[model samples]
Target: MPFKASGRATDYRAIDRFDGGAGWIAHPEETMQRASHVLRASGGEADGGAWVVDPVNADGVDDLLAEFGDVRGVVVLMDRHARDAAAVADRHDVPVYVPSFVDPDVDAQTQPLGGTLPDSDYEVVRTVDWPGWDEAALSDGETLVVGDAVGTTEYFRAGGERVGVHPLLRVKPPRALRQFRPERILTGHGEGVLTDATRALQDALDGARRNAPEVWLNGLKALV
Candidate 1:
């Protein structure tokens, strides 16, 4: 499993294209399989604009974003996920938005995320605020975008889950996410869960602790 260091991706594979927008996995062949998402949202003074979340740059991504609308801002949900955020924000001449509690080492100018995103209906939800891990989620009831609290990747899920809590957090799943009953769940890793998303999220959180052993065993099997 090659670790994708924080920088521009050499190539990427697009996935999870939906009505709102699309997502892509940088270095898709890598085992970690980090995925980034974008959403076309509107509110307040703006009509429609694309908000890139935890992005990893690759060819044709700009064109993909263009299909949605103008790039409004780049959002970093987790403190450690500054992957290509500054680069993408700089390219679009927008500021990188992060939660006020986090202070990532990106070069671009940043704004504290709160309330609803400027000109968009997406609301930020504080998911985790631990010593080393800080994360936030975005939602508008129908679509939910998460950082590291949960994911759909092989590393994140157990045997029967469409989405699963992160291995480290499974023992104590983030309670804040239970409030959302989204029709689609977009994650910062792996592909989004497009169908049965609400049930998937509920199951993931409700079963996280009980399934921790299974998840651990599955990880061991993969390593073997």
Candidate 2:
């Protein structure tokens, strides 16, 4: 789906929140549509350093920092998903990592996502030739964290059931993402897949491939 203006967007309330074993994900209220995530190294690393992804609620900042220990980095998945990132970064005195292709409108200083993560636990992959946005995802070999280049809203189910790509993204799934065999997927929108992540990703890609017309129509609507 095209990015809807925030004015028309519903306020998200938390629905599900948990540590995805290897990582932590906080689902936005009510909808499995969006979330704030923290990617950390195994064994909790001594420094507790972590990368924050597309944070939304400022009221929960203290709790997030507490859980993650220290914010080594703040990342905005796409320009549209920069919500609360500036505030969160400023609160922790860290730089916001954005895609290199577009100018970030947030107040904080911005750095390119590449090789900027506090540790090597995560890698940023930019989605090339994506329509109307410069998008990216964070991967740690076993997990993939994303804002919206891919999503699970369309396929969401109760009890943390696995979901597929955002309806809009089914038109053109990025090959960069397809290459990763993530065991879990932490998504900005949609409840995350805590199990069978690699298979879930492949399923999402297959669903997109089968829904080419729906994807094309969504893309055209965004243009109009």
Candidate 3:
């Protein structure tokens, strides 16, 4: 079954809820299995305000945001993942933020993101910057949020990876991500890795090339 986007989600499943953050998959049954996240500013000026990332609009998404506080902004980490970002940002009356290195082809107003996420400790890490592929990751030392370059989805993993490099990138995994040792990794697809995330990430990067053949086979099976 090829991946297909669904209409506005009627229901969503919440996941990765921590002290100051939470995540949800709006279209849980969709093959793409895209997930969105909200991270609240812990102690900064933006305290209580939360940032939404790669959102896919759902019926009660606003209620989920209310749990953390006000919605500050909507962030798009992958150029191709414009998803419901603009619509969500408009609904929240906030700006849509795209990484400074990314020139998304979406038809919406966007703010260039660089350095740290405004009002939060999350620092933007440029993960991929090739001609057609531009992606970014965010981390505040503890929780790591990635999009596209890596994921926990069935199509993204091989035999026993808690997380794995995106199948297309398996042969040349993003080295920029090797620097962090996050306690938990939230992705744009599938569920997050909440335990032993550091080792899971390291294994994914270190074994990405070596496991390419298996990943390819897994991806093929997923498509069928």
| TM agreement with the true structure for every prediction | 0.93, 0.75, 0.95
Residues 71-171, candidate 2: write the lDDT tens digits: 77778878787777888798889899887765557889888766435565677777545557677777767777777756665433212325555555555
- Evaluated with TM-score, which candidate comes out highest? 3
Q: How high a TM-score does candidate 2 get?
A: 0.75
Clashes of each: 0, 9, 0
| lDDT comparing candidate 1 with the true structure | 0.85
How much lDDT does each candidate structure score? 0.85, 0.62, 0.87
Residue 196 shift from truth in candidate 3, angstroms: 1.2
Worst 10 residues of 1 by lDDT: 38-47
Clashing pairs in 1: none
RMSD to the hidden true structure, all candidates: 2.1, 5.2, 1.6
lDDT ranking, best first: 3, 1, 2
- What does candidate 3's lDDT look like per residue over 85-112, in tens digits? 9899888788899898876665567889
In model 1, how large is the Cα lDDT of residue 80? 84
lDDT of 1 by residue, 28-102 (tens): 866667889878867422358889999988977897788778898999999888988999999999999988876
lDDT of 2 at 198: 89
